[model samples]
Structure formats: structure tokens, C-alpha cells
Target: MDIEIAFGQPRPWTETVAWGPYRARHADLFEFVMPGVARYTLEDRSRVTVTPEDGADEAPIGEMLVATVLPSLIWARGDVVLHASAIARPGQNAGLMFVGASGSGKSSRLQRAVGRNARVIADDSARVYLQDGELLASGLPGGMFIRTHDAADSRTLVSVPPEQQLKALPVTSMLILGNDDSPVRRLTGVEALASLLRHRHRPRILRLLGTEADFIGPLGDIAARLRIAVVGVRAWMP
Candidate 1:
């Protein structure tokens, strides 16, 4: 495992940056307090400690660890945690990613891809980083969380899971979800770069951590290599 998770009391912060009652960070350790749920401590991108609160069980806390805590740790570092979902064809290691604002149907499109026998690379928060002169994505294995009848409620769709361990996969295709007039249009040069920057996870955290500049080195390469395009709902063909 790339990260180790433990349940215990978190250590106190030496220097703290608190944005609100729920968010705070210091050095390489990050803290998230989900009122009455759990207190999560993400340290140095490798370990997370969950301290239960208000008699909360391990299930919900563990869920939040994957959903929010893990992503936050990835974002805190120089790497890019995208607001995206991805799937790759059987026998193919590379992925086709769907990226855009949250609730822009990334989850639904991911579901559709699953129905077609595509393997899920990431459900919502796609962890991408540069390694060995290429952009590699982590196959974050877990249930596919999608919205249900109620806007506030979510349901997990079980599909063929990725390998039990985390491994990197190439992402050669990317689609930017939007309300464009065209059915599908490939982006290039400045257009593609702009679209990618707008879809990264939690820009606010980058701003807070002052590591936005750290990812600049990889952004250009990702935009240049991936065949990114703007596609509307139901426009994805093959």
C-alpha cells in the first residue's frame, strides 16, 4: 500500500493553518474534522490516523478516509488530484478520463463505461502524477460511488475492481465535460491547457499550501500528451 491507515489519537500541530472549523494543516500533517463523524490526520502522504468521535464506527470513517482524506493528502503534495473519473479497456493499461466540475456527470459516464466492460481506474478523484518522463494515474480501487434519487444521497455500484494494490496506469485520452455546442471537439495548445487547469481538485488547498507552482512542471506535459476534448452529455462514442 502506498499509504498506511491507523486508528489512534492524532498528534498536535506545531504550526497550524486553520481555514475553518473543519480544515487545518501543519507541515506535512493535515487534519480533517467531520463533526461527530471522525477526526482524520493525514501525515506526509503515507499514513492516516482515524480517531473516532461521538461513537462513530470504522465504516464511515474509513469511507471518508478514501473520499476526502486521501485526496487532500495527494493535493497537498505537488501532485495533481483531479476532479475526474476514468476507465480503461480490457487488456489496455491506459485510461480515458472524464474531467470537469463536480456533478458534471463524471460518475454517470464512468458507470456507462463500466457497463461496456471497461475497468474503472478511478471513480471520482483521479490521482495523477509525473514519473519516469510520463504522466501516470493510480488505480484507486473501491466501490463506484454515484448519486441516487435524492440529490444528497449516494449509492455504490460494484463492478470488476482493479488490482488489490495501487499501481500506475497511463492516461492517453481525456474528455472535458461541458455544454459546448459541438458534439465533440478536440482541444489544442492554449485551449487544452486552460481546460486542464480548471478541472484539478481543490484549488483552494493548493492556494493554502502554496504548492500551486509545484505542479506547473507536469501540467504542460499532461496537456501536450493527452488527447483532450470537450464533449457534451451522451456525446461519447467509443
Candidate 2:
């Protein structure tokens, strides 16, 4: 099946990505040569392709392919895509997402939650959209990378062979990470809207969509229906 994904910018590649039993519509971003295989050509005349070893499972490469493709799709669909880690309950009763810049421990906290048996919704980046009367957090294409103070100790946690781990999960709450020693807290109404807009992937999109005028209203509605918060985790014991 050929899945055509539209994008805001012209696709850099003129080729199609072929995977096992499936072919993906490629634009300029990147392309996958097979299941779990990816090729990215940089302007510096360098190309990087992620391919699985012989007889190895192709799921990881497949995931990389989706990660490369899904964000653009979500952006084109007019939904917000943010860099964050998210978790949801098994029955989907409520969910939470953490967003931040690199080294903010977004993935670390997510991995920690896995130890606590919290069902991971997504890692690295998540796509949020509204369906029916509720804002649903859904899993996107990318995987999470675990970083630990001790490289050796990281292995004990979500160990995927070959020393690299990647898994897909669902997203529920929208939590922006900021440095603080205060306890975790939920945000609602104007506070929630402010938090979301502050961390939104593309603020210009809001203006473009003409949703800027009512952005706070929609975000407040979503926050009320779902769980949203800003969490502060300390590096040292309290």
C-alpha cells in the first residue's frame, strides 16, 4: 500500500520507500528502503541509513521510518506535535505527557515510570488531536532512548537487545518540564492554556489555522476533559 503524506515543505527526495509488503509515499524529508531501514541524505553530501542485521527483526527500522514520517503527517493534519514523553492508564481513563528540551530528563522520567508499571504512551515526540468531545493522546512513530548516569545500570531498565531500545506508547497528559523543586501539580483553565501554548510545537500554526483567537478556549476544554500538568523533578533527594 502506498501512503501519501502531505507536507508543508517540498519533499527533498523523488523516490519511494519500500518495506516488506508495503511501500510508503515519500516526500523530501527521508525514505526507508525496507522494514527497519532508513536513508537520510544531508546537504553535506553524507547519507545515513539505518538497516537491521541479517535475520534480525525489522521492527526497529520500521519504527524509525514511522518516526521520520508521522510528525510531518501530524503537522499537515493541523494537530499539534510536540517533543515530549507521555503515559496513559491501561483503560485510557487518564494520561500524562512531559515536554522539554534535550537533557531535561523527559525520557528518564518516562523510563522511571515504566519501573512503576505506568503504561507508556509515547516517547521522544507525541501527537495530540481532538476526537469527538475529548482530546486524545495517541502514539506516534518514534522510539525512546534511555540515558542513565551509569551506562551499565541503564541496561536493567527497558532492555532491548543490541544496546538500543525503542518502543511506542500512547499519550494522555500534557506536562511541560521546567526546573523546580516544587511537587508535581495539575494546571487548568487559563493556567493550562498558558502552559500548552508556551510549549506548542508551532505557535505560528495556531495563527495560520485561525484558531489563535480561540486557542485558550479549546485548550481549556481539552485540559478540563483530560489531565494536564507541569512537573518538577529534583536531581537530589528532598
Candidate 3:
């Protein structure tokens, strides 16, 4: 339940960090390496062990936690975590979520949603779970998808998390945001499953941990009840 930071004494990686970012080990333990930050090990889906790179700043470590580490832990615990964003509007009963792969415009749409004064349930890596047969989403502590042009690169995003702890909000609709000409359409059955599977956070680790197949039933229920659609990037408030 705590992050143990280690220096000098590094955990051995079977493969080089550059070539191997993720290693599929025993179901109880998982270890991964990320450049420009630190090496991370998820212990039994409960605790985190971090090995910072030489002179690595704590800022990058915090960013990587929200980016991958935290979500990996949540995903390992059997929750349906997606590299997606969620937003809720006033007087609305259910929140809306946007899901897509990297560079699919999910973040841009999220920035726009926040600009519209919509309440942010989560930014990237929306942690979803079932509560009494109802699907709900809870944002990670530092949940906000914001890219700073002044930063090192175009992919560098700074997250300003909420001031207080966030609560899980019911989700009734999900949209796959894309720039393509794909008409706005509802996805169901195999289509929904396939789309959702593609955007799962750290799917390789989940598959290695033998929990990927466990999502079929839960995802089916989520897709069947919720309005999962594919919306073009130009279309908003869809």
C-alpha cells in the first residue's frame, strides 16, 4: 500500500530497459521499465516499489504513476481501466466517457470538454468498476490530460489533479473519438468488445497476468447497457 523508493541497488531486469518495457512474470508480481523516469514493480496489486533512474526528478515519477503505474495496479485488481477520459454535465444522470488509442484525439476532446465547464470525472486512464450491477468510473488522484506546448515535446502532458479526492460517477455512454470520416454510429456485440479491448491500459500486462479474459463478461454488460459509439473528432456534444 506504499511506494518504496530504492536507489543504487536496482532490481534486476531480465531484459534491457530499452528493449523490454514490460515483463510478464508471476501473476502476483509485475515489473516494468520506463525511460526518463524510473523502474516500477507492482506487488500483488497492492503496493508499488519504484527504482528511480540516476538523478531522476520526483516530478517525472509522479507523472509516470498517473500515466501507467497506478492504472496498471487498478487493472491488475480486476477493474476495467481504460486509457480514456470521462466528463459529466450538470443535471445529467450519467457521465460520458471518451475512449481511444494514443493519438486518437481523446485528450484534445477532453480539454475541450473541460473548457465547456463540464465536470471532469476522469482524464486519461479512467478506472471503471461495477457496483451492485451498475458501472461506475473514478478518476485517478492526478487526473487531467493536458499537454504543454512549452514542454520538451508534443507528447509531454502536465496533469493537474483535483484538490479533493474524487468519487465514482455512474457512466451510461462511451464514445471512441477519432479524426477519420467514420460516421457517428453505435457499436455493439463484437464491435464494442473489440474497440474497448484495443484501448485497455497496459493490456500486455493484463494478458500476462491472466486477467484479460476475465473482462469479457463485464465488458459485455457494460457495452450492452451503455451507449458505446464512434464519433468523429469534428463532432462535439454527440
- Top candidate by TM-score: 1
TM-score of model 1 vs. true structure: 0.86
Error of 2 at 158 (Å): 6.8
**How do all the candidates rank in terms of TM-score, highest first?**
1, 3, 2
Candidate 3 residue spans exceeding 4 A from truth = 1-19, 149-165
lDDT of 3 by residue, 183-203 (tens): 899888889877888878777
Measured against the true structure, the TM-scores of the candidates, in listed sequence, are 0.86, 0.54, 0.83
Candidate 3 — which pairs collide? none
Worst 10 residues of 1 by lDDT: 159-168
Clashing pairs in 1: none
Q: Would you give me the overall lDDT of model 2? A: 0.51
lDDT of 1 by residue, 1-238 (tens): 3678888897777535666534556537767788878888778868888888978866677667777777888876667777787777756768778886655676777667666777776776788777787777774645677767676555555544555223457789898887544688899988887877897866666765667787776777788888998888667743
How big is the positional error of residue 16 in model 1, measured in Å on the Cα after superposition? 3.2
Go through the candidates in order and give the C-alpha RMSD of each one to the true structure: 2.7, 9.9, 3.6
What is the model-wide C-alpha lDDT for candidate 1? 0.72
Ranking by lDDT: 1, 3, 2
Q: After the best TM-score superposition of candidate 2, give how far the Cα of residue 29 lies from its true spot, in angstroms.
A: 11
Which has the higher TM-score value, candidate number 2 or candidate number 3?
Answer: 3
